[model samples]
Target: MPARYFTLEEANALLPELEPVMAELLARRAKVVRQRHKIAPILDDPHGDMGGAAATEMALDFVRITELVEQVQAFGCLLKDLNTGLLDFLSERDGREVYLCWRYGEPRIEYYHELHTGFTGRQRY
Candidate 1:
């Protein structure tokens, strides 16, 4: 379990701040993917000139991705999937630990799942 846990209200309160970060995260991630595709062909060529702008931009994207990930973690939540914008916060449900799940576009946290289960196992909380 994570060192921090969040109550429903506390988790909901973070939504407003989280939304904008997620938007940027999603956009930056997409940009990185596209950048990677552009450079993939030359990646294995050790002699290929990778010092160009594309490589530099990709490196910057990766750095930004790391920064964004750390920002989310600083909020005491786990980023489960980038493609779906799934986030999980540690919380106790019933009698045991579970993840309070939130997906992109959802107004607030409305679901949870066991540690072993992922999105498909999410149940309304």
Candidate 2:
């Protein structure tokens, strides 16, 4: 697919909708993590069947995570991290494609990086 290049204003404007979805994604991810910890012993057992409750919750968590991820992608943005709620909107600057980075709690989209540089290369928007 052609890249969806968002302007700074367009990226920031998506926050109201994106923030809540990111929040829910983080919450569901945390639940999955905690549930995995709780079931680690059972999972380690060679022939262990994950008990009904844990299995059910794990399945639910996976399904919910998938749904939340799809919602985020429907915005034509990349979800970088669920735990930290990092997102990147494909954008163009100075004649090149870059990512406009936003974390969960930031007031607005204020950082960006080259496509190959990743988060550590974030520059002020």
Candidate 3:
């Protein structure tokens, strides 16, 4: 699919929808991490078989995480850092493509950066 570009207003409008999905994504991610930690020692035994329940929970978490991730991509936004809750919407500014950046807990979209710049290069919008 071709890239979808957003105007500033359009990107702002998506925040409400994006926030909840991100929250779920983060929650599931944490669960996955916790589940992995729980299973790590067992797996280290080399001869240990992953118990059915633990395996099921991890599989479910993975499926849900994948679904949540696809939802974000469906909105044409990138989930950059789950740990930091950073999201980016592709947009054009001054005739150049840039990522309109927003992090969780921020009031709204207030920064942007070049396609190659990533978060550190973000500038106030």
Candidate 4:
């Protein structure tokens, strides 16, 4: 699929949407860490009689939390890439005004070809 490109104005407008999602993901990641810490004592108590069943449950929960953290970390990386990918007002080689693009779901900035670049110059996946 051809990637969608956002103009500076459009990208700026998207900050409001992106910021909250980024914040929520980061907060959730932190929560996951806190949860792991809380469970660590239970898992590490050498003398505590955590039965096989309880230990198994804790192990499963830890794995689930780790997976969630990885997912959120991926999202955070995407957000950071979008935030830092391109200059605010880039001038194309042809001297036309171009802006960095960061549409939803894009892995990274692939081009800043022209103000008219639109989806045409957008690298296809």
The per-model lDDT (C-alpha) reads 0.90, 0.91, 0.90, 0.46
Q: Model 3: per-residue lDDT, tens digit, 80-109?
A: 998878999999999999999999889899
Runs in model 1 deviating more than 4 A are 44-48
RMSD of every candidate to native, in Å, equals: 1.9, 1.6, 1.4, 10.4
lDDT of 2 by residue, 1-125 (tens): 77788999999999999989988899889888888888889878878885568978899889999999999999999999777999999999999999999999999999999999999999998
| Arranged by TM-score, best first | 2, 3, 1, 4
lDDT for predicted candidate 2 compared with the true structure:
0.91
Q: Weakest 10 consecutive residues, lDDT, candidate 1?
A: 42-51
Decide which is better by TM-score, 1 or 3: 3
| Candidate number that wins on lDDT, 3 or 4 | 3
Model 4, residue 105: C-alpha shift (Å): 21
Looking at model 3, how many pairs of residues clash?
0
* lDDT accuracy of residue 113 in candidate 2: 99
TM-score of 3: 0.91
> What are the clashing pairs of model 4?
none
Clashing residue pairs for model 2? none
Predicted model with the maximum lDDT: 2
TM-score of each: 0.90, 0.92, 0.91, 0.39
Error of 1 at 79 (Å): 0.8
Model 2, which residues run further than 4 Å from truth? 44-49
Weakest lDDT window of 10 consecutive positions for candidate 3: 43-52
